[model samples]
Target chain A: MTPEQENQIRESFDHQSMMTTFGASLDDLTPGTCRISAPILDGNQQQHGFGHAALTFGLGDTAAGYAAMSVMEPGHEVLTAEIKISLVSPAKGYRLIAEGTVLRAGRRLITVEAKVFAKDAGENRLIAVLLGTMVPVKPKPTAT
Target chain B: MTPEQENQIRESFDHQSMMTTFGASLDDLTPGTCRISAPILDGNQQQHGFGHAALTFGLGDTAAGYAAMSVMEPGHEVLTAEIKISLVSPAKGYRLIAEGTVLRAGRRLITVEAKVFAKDAGENRLIAVLLGTMVPVKPKPTAT
Candidate 1:
């Protein structure tokens, strides 16, 4: 990634509000890769005694979005244009870990894959796997 | 749509803990078709004074899932394996309306497309468009 791209990625990561909702943050983000974490909340539970699908989805999306952004040009913003998540196991835990890898990066779109896992009860099971497509747009040029 | 599939779609629609969480019903679902509504809620707002992305994505996924389910057999289930939502406008105060259409239905995966809109001040503007892939699974046969 270009130096300008790295700064843009950092700025983008810092401006997100959804992270506050999930208590999630980027642990490590580099060109083509990223790791995200969040703690489950009481509101994340469903009647089936697992984290709601929406919460898991949100975390997975974040990881994929950031990973895609990491690989983009400096001043380009990555927006999720499409994604798929497969739930493999119940999410019953305090913390969720999401790691995303860039599969294909193009001028217009980036494809990212992510896996979400829960750590609790001394067992770590994959909760969800996500496939996301991100669109990249040039940032508005400075007025100066 | 098969009669068995219709019944299964109804069953999926009927199983909801938060009944008020969604607007409309099975009557609104059809293969390559859908209708969805979301009530106005203060908690569903984002910083842009519009509905949260979570709410929009949930409604979009439900519509797509149900639309896919409407084309399957009674004992089968349609699970959302992938989705992509783009935000074009702020959610605003209007009730959200979503329409999901089947793009392709294959033996392994069904692709559905969804559009989200809001009746903003009596005008509907596209907010997000999502493409989803729904996976179908077989159901157990009845006991003899």
Candidate 2:
């Protein structure tokens, strides 16, 4: 897809939706890469007063999903078939950024990896990592 | 760990701190085995209005983590090192149950499998499945 078309497709992810209810936004997207960010909020706090594990994982998956979608065909859609998010460090900060890339693309599935970094005290720390599989929807043949 | 202590630890993972927060309470615990369950909530919806993929993974990982803890010796703790959750169906339902089992227990890590099922209009649907690795923490010796 052309750069203009790719930008339009990235816009369709709707980062403001519930999956990103805590204020997530996509900053960049390309053929096989994506970057999203979210600001930490009191509402997202767990007992630890840090970003909840659930929220952290959500952000990472969103990045990975978008990364896979960027490389897929225009008519093809990608959905998570499987995923794994590992919490490496507690997320305690004002903002977090997730960078994701497509590791492999296949006919039926795509593999992606995402890493989340939290901005803390003006320093960035790796907080989480995610690996996931995205399954592409098969297009139905059009009858002429 | 003693069977009695195991019971208490299992219960702790279940008590909810908030209505939106659901947890799997330990219903049963034995060496190398554990069972827990939690209800699904709309607030946990992902971008597609289905149960969030990350939440599903967390539940699976928690189940696997606790199951690994059940079989560890006293003073040992368990943490999820890695997890893979498969989303088979849209997690539409009232409740989701995850049954976890220890597939292989090693001195350093334990492998566990979790099956997530949702009750859909009185029919059971396999919504997700998970495989996780739990790292065991050994107690440190105190200086005399």
Candidate 3:
């Protein structure tokens, strides 16, 4: 993907409401992969000080969406068709990172996988795994 | 489920950070079933004025968790082990509702499903579906 394409994807993340609500941000974007990260905020945690699964899932799914977008053409956007996430371990850390990779990219359909890791004091532990399918679509009229 | 059990789950939802952040509320709780609802807010929508996928997923997953909790013993809580959500249609509405039902309850795991509906002008449309595995866990020390 070109730099313009990458910038386009990043800008869309700005319009994603749940990402902002969870204090999440897009960290990296490559040809067929993306990384989204969020802090373990006091207002976004569950009972055990672990990152709430909802927030974790949001970051992971957004990463998958952007990863799929990275592989598509610039004018086209992507929407999630389906997403599955399994929590392997409790995410208790200062920050969480979701790394998404496109497994297959078809004309209309794309399959992506994201792995979320919890980083505490420079040590990272795998916390969750996500699998999703994204579909390319024309830009919405309201695209900001 | 007993009234005592319902109250316990209700109290727990009060402490769930993400639910509060999303302005979500538990609308109903019964044995093997739950309903969670949230309003469409400007800070939590996607490009088309639809509720962001993450917000919808969070509502669905919380309903699934509470549904499983309702069927379990009083001192036992539930956590999401795995979750899958499929976006069937765009959610353009004033409010979103997720109704969750338990499919099976096992010794250690419970399977549940949630259907998300978007309501506009008193008309409702199915927008998404969620399936989840919830595992029973001991109550946290701070649980009310």
The candidate that achieves the highest TM-score relative to the unseen native structure? 3
What is candidate 1's local distance difference test score? 0.71
Given candidate 3, what's the lDDT at residue A80? 96
Residue lDDT tens for model 2, A1-144: 567546645554562244555577888888788888888765555433567665677778878887888877776656788888777876788888999899998878899999999999999999989988998764346410
lDDT of candidates 1 onward, in order:
0.71, 0.71, 0.88
* Model 2 misplacement above 4 A: A1-18, A39-52, A92-94, A138-144, B1-4, B7-20, B23-28, B138-144
In candidate 3, stretches whose alpha carbon ends up further than 4 angstroms from where it belongs are A142-144, B140-144
DockQ, cand. 1: 0.19
Full ranking by DockQ = 3, 2, 1
Across B113-140, the per-residue lDDT of candidate 1 in tens digits comes to 8888887788888888888788887643
- Per-residue alpha-carbon lDDT of candidate 2 for residues B34-94, written as tens digits (9 for 90 to 100): 6665666555665445566656665666667778888776666565677778889877777
Please report how far candidate 3 places residue B48 from its true position, in Å: 3.8
Candidate 3 at residue B125, lDDT? 93
Query: Candidate 2 chain B, which ten residues in sequence have the lowest lDDT sum?
Result: B11-20
Cα lDDT tens digits, model 1, A1-144, are 877876766666555544555567779878898888887765544433456566677778778887898887766677667677777775777788989999999888898999999988887779989887888866556411
lDDT at residue B46 of model 3 (Cα atoms): 77
- Per-model TM-score versus the true fold: 0.67, 0.78, 0.95
Candidate 2: how close is chain B to the reference, as a TM-score? Answer: 0.81
